[model samples]
Target: MAVLKLSGTLNSEPQGKSHPEAGSDSSLSFLHGTKLAYASNLVRDWHADLLHYQGLKPGSAKLHRDNLLRLLNHARVAPWELQKDHVTRYFESRVNQETGQMLAPATVGTYCAAWRGFQNYMLTAERVNELFSEFNVRPKAFVDDDNSIAVKRHKLNWVPKGWALTDLEIDAIDETFRSEIARAAREHSKSLLPLLRDRVMFHVGIHFALRISELTELRVSSFCASLDADLQHFGKWGVLTVTGKGDVTGSVPMRDPSVHGLIEWYTNSVRQKILLRRKSKTEDDGRREIKGQMVSVSDLMFPSERGGVVCPNGFRKRLADIAMKSGVLRRKLTPHTLRHTGCTLMVPLYSPEIAQKYMRHKHLHTTLYYYHPTPLGAANEVNSAAQLFDDEEED
Candidate 1:
């Protein structure tokens, strides 16, 4: 994957300062002459590393790598000289990928955040825009309010959190899967059914509070240990080492009983069938099997029926169907909802602080947003209360 490359000539900015050892700023205009006075080597390194990390994934690595390369080409410049408008344009540039439409402001802002973070870290003290240029774009296929929208950083908690699955919703979801899981386990008798995978995903995501990125990155190697492993032990419960967005690595214990059962079925039963199918090849006798195949856990934690690794999209749809069919979520179930639900469930089990740690949130404010309050209509409540007070006073 290639990003539309950025181009520019290096020309001296009168206001720019040359690096202490370098000659003039004329030779260093980078990022299409977009370097900020605020960036430092540390921030540059981080950005470079993250760009490289993105390459490990299928499509995004190329975009980030291009962005990083653009920045690196300009890395020698001082931060103050870089302009926000240029930064804005860099992020806002349209790509046929992601969506055919113009890029969202939020996406732009996300890129700016990286750019700005690099600048800020270097003490350039620059903001991406006077106001965030980010937008939460709505698709034309479309609707009224953009509830399923991304947000600009209009407020600290601009990512207004979704409430946890209500108790009724949670109960229904559980009920929906309990039988489906049993039926799945029973149907294949020797191997678990597709439904069991969904149920296990529900418990892992909702109960364990994992982002699907973390979940999708899971490998059979991620869960090689015994499901009955001890929690007091280090690296127990399969020791799933997940590299999340921005390429942050976090080791989460795969401790949910449901995840355990699901994995057990996969490793012991489903995996054998998968391996056998993968090994199949039309030989002299016209049959397909890995007669002399080289196999690894990368083979799959949950492979497609064709014995290939399960992609995130497939995992998401299957998980959603489990939620919808089982009724855990009243609305269309998203993989993300499990994360929201996991945070909510943790509220009663843990302090908000501990829950945040479990989720690996960088900010406590973000953690606090996980709790959903019952919305009360302010006007109706006030009017009713005032009327009752007046009636009581007259009596």
Candidate 2:
């Protein structure tokens, strides 16, 4: 039993007595007979649900567990005793220790989501009320709209310069990468391989408008180098297919000759050298069982130095370095920034329907919101409408 303090609160610290009758886990033996221990067990059960029911992979589920643990540790209170204010204060107080900057709204929103999911599970799970009865504390919803930063629409305004790059910016990046590659090749520098890999990732990621997750998930066989010559415009284009979020598969035609050639060179020479260096045995056509279904899995297109999928953090950092060298305004180049650039560039060339399909979005609204953010307001629309009348008068 927990000892009630003079302030009418139970001390969250573990008692000196052990509970052998409860359970015997040597690592957590010190936490036995404490509310913290009970809360930890609840988190373990929640982690299992996240895997079996929510279909989240182990790493993702562990992230949720870690987030909750931070709260439990900070609050120093039992799980059922947690209130909305406790949750709100935790998020509000979050800051980047190194930079001394507050947490991003999007990141705060993700933490809110994890809390909401766990709270929901706590309220509905069988015998949860009975478990809480011992502590005489009723479980309540911890996260609500009052503290949540969740928004239905993208907050592109958060980044004043904007997430998407203009046409000039895109051209500048490409030209800079090309110039750097030429210089490195001429000098026979050791950095050529990494430069080539980053260039391929940039070009392919932008053209495909792929999420960082999708880009990293790409396999060696994801690219189809040839298409039927009888297929008109698509004939000369290669295909880059990826399995995106929610297991939805989509393929986009690779049209840029420069991008196509980069893919070929990287695959034929660079990737082979990486594999040879690591002596990695990952096959192009490997199979794995997922959700009781046999699905094809293979070696990653952009493997790490040790021969695994390239870390997204490392990828982002390298891209940021490239952007810095290119003298781009926004040196932090997230994969979504490239996605926005690709989608924006495609908006004029393709119809909304086509753009939606290419973006692999279930709804046309998503495509429009991402690609057609009207930062300039109706000025462009007004000019275009006026041009129509000018053309008619000339005719």
lDDT of 2 by residue, 246-311 (tens): 667787777676776777688888877765565345563344443454544335677666555677
* Superposition error at 151 for model 1 (Å): 9.0
Q: Per-residue lDDT tens digits of candidate 1, residues 1-395? A: 23332222231123454442122222334434223322344344545555564334434433433343344444333343444444433334444445445445455444444454444433422233411222122112111113212233334345664657766776677687776667766666533544555556566677567787666545555543434447534233555655566455655555456556655665676556655655334532322222233444334555545554446687777667666676445566777877887876664455555666677776665655565533453123322222322322110
Candidate 2 C-alpha error for residue 245, in Å: 7.2
Q: List residue ranges in candidate 1 displaced over 4 A.
A: 1-153, 156-163, 178-192, 223-239, 254-266, 269-271, 277-295, 373-395
Clashing pairs in 2: none
Each candidate: RMSD: 14.0, 10.4
Top candidate on TM-score is 2
Shift of residue 221 alpha carbon in model 1, Å = 3.0
List TM-scores for all candidates, in order. Answer: 0.53, 0.55
Off by over 4 Å in 2: 1-45, 66-111, 125-139, 147-162, 177-201, 211-218, 225-238, 243-250, 255-258, 261-336, 347-395
- Candidate no. 2 TM-score: 0.55
